[model samples]
Target: MDFRSLFTRKSKSSSIATQRLQLILTQDRFEVSEDSMKKLQIELTEVLAKYFEFTMNSVSMSIKREGNSYVLMADFPYSKTNKIR
Candidate 1:
């Protein structure tokens, strides 16, 4: 058994677990529920669909903590041909 391989594998696994924990903690800290996030995404998609021809997958939304306030961030991929306006 190679000792170095064990350390390397454990480090990679630990890093991923740590990142996931941090994400969960941040989400909890902001008190943002998964259902609410999904609802927001659906509503935003419906509204944007009126003016754009893009797949729901093209829109991405996330909540970011900025100082004492939470910021809602959204990104939409737009193409000239996809514009309904």
Candidate 2:
């Protein structure tokens, strides 16, 4: 009977679904064979770490279906300290 509860449940469900869909779509676009994605993830993480000290789990880099083509989207947290080096 509470609208707030309904909204919260819907929001959580939608977020989970979106994340799941995005992962699947990304895997599909990259044509990442089972072992390949694992290799790619590791290599990318190492490369990124060479530049900054950040949590690998906190960053996401992937190729996704956008319109008729696939697009690579990477998200990283920025901090003012990065400007120094």
Candidate 3:
């Protein structure tokens, strides 16, 4: 019996399942979901459009770990070159 192969398969599946569970729990705590995040990005683009110009994928946001806590961070590729006035 190849115990190594059995152990490898078990661990791989376990790791993937664990990661998925963590993602679900984290998203729950944050009160957000993948669909909501996409909607938020689109809405933000529309609202910010009146003041700034940015192409598709120019803005980004995500929840990430920083030290011991998770944070929702957003980025907007900013430029005053094409500011709407």
Q: Scored by CA lDDT, what does every candidate get?
A: 0.75, 0.72, 0.74
Can you write out model 3's per-residue Cα lDDT over 1-85, one digit (the tens) per residue? 8767766645577778988876676567568877886788888888887777867557777567789988877788887685784
RMSD of each: 6.9, 4.4, 9.3
In candidate 1, which residue pairs get closer than 3 Å at backbone N, Cα or C atoms, i.e. clash?
none
lDDT of prediction 3: 0.74
Q: Say which candidate scores most in TM-score.
A: 2
Q: Pick the candidate with the highest lDDT.
A: 1
Q: Name model 2 segments beyond 4 Å from true.
A: 1-11, 82-85
Model 3: number of clashes?
0
When sorted by lDDT, best at the front, the candidate numbers are 1, 3, 2
Model 2 global lDDT (CA atoms, 0 to 1): 0.72
Writing each residue's lDDT as its tens digit, candidate 1 over 1-85 gives: 9878876745577778988776576567657886776777778988999888878857766567789987867788888889795
Candidate 2 residue-wise lDDT, 1-85, digit = tens: 9767866745577778999888887788777874777677667766777787666655676786678977787777668765523
| Model 1, runs deviating above 4 Å | 1-26
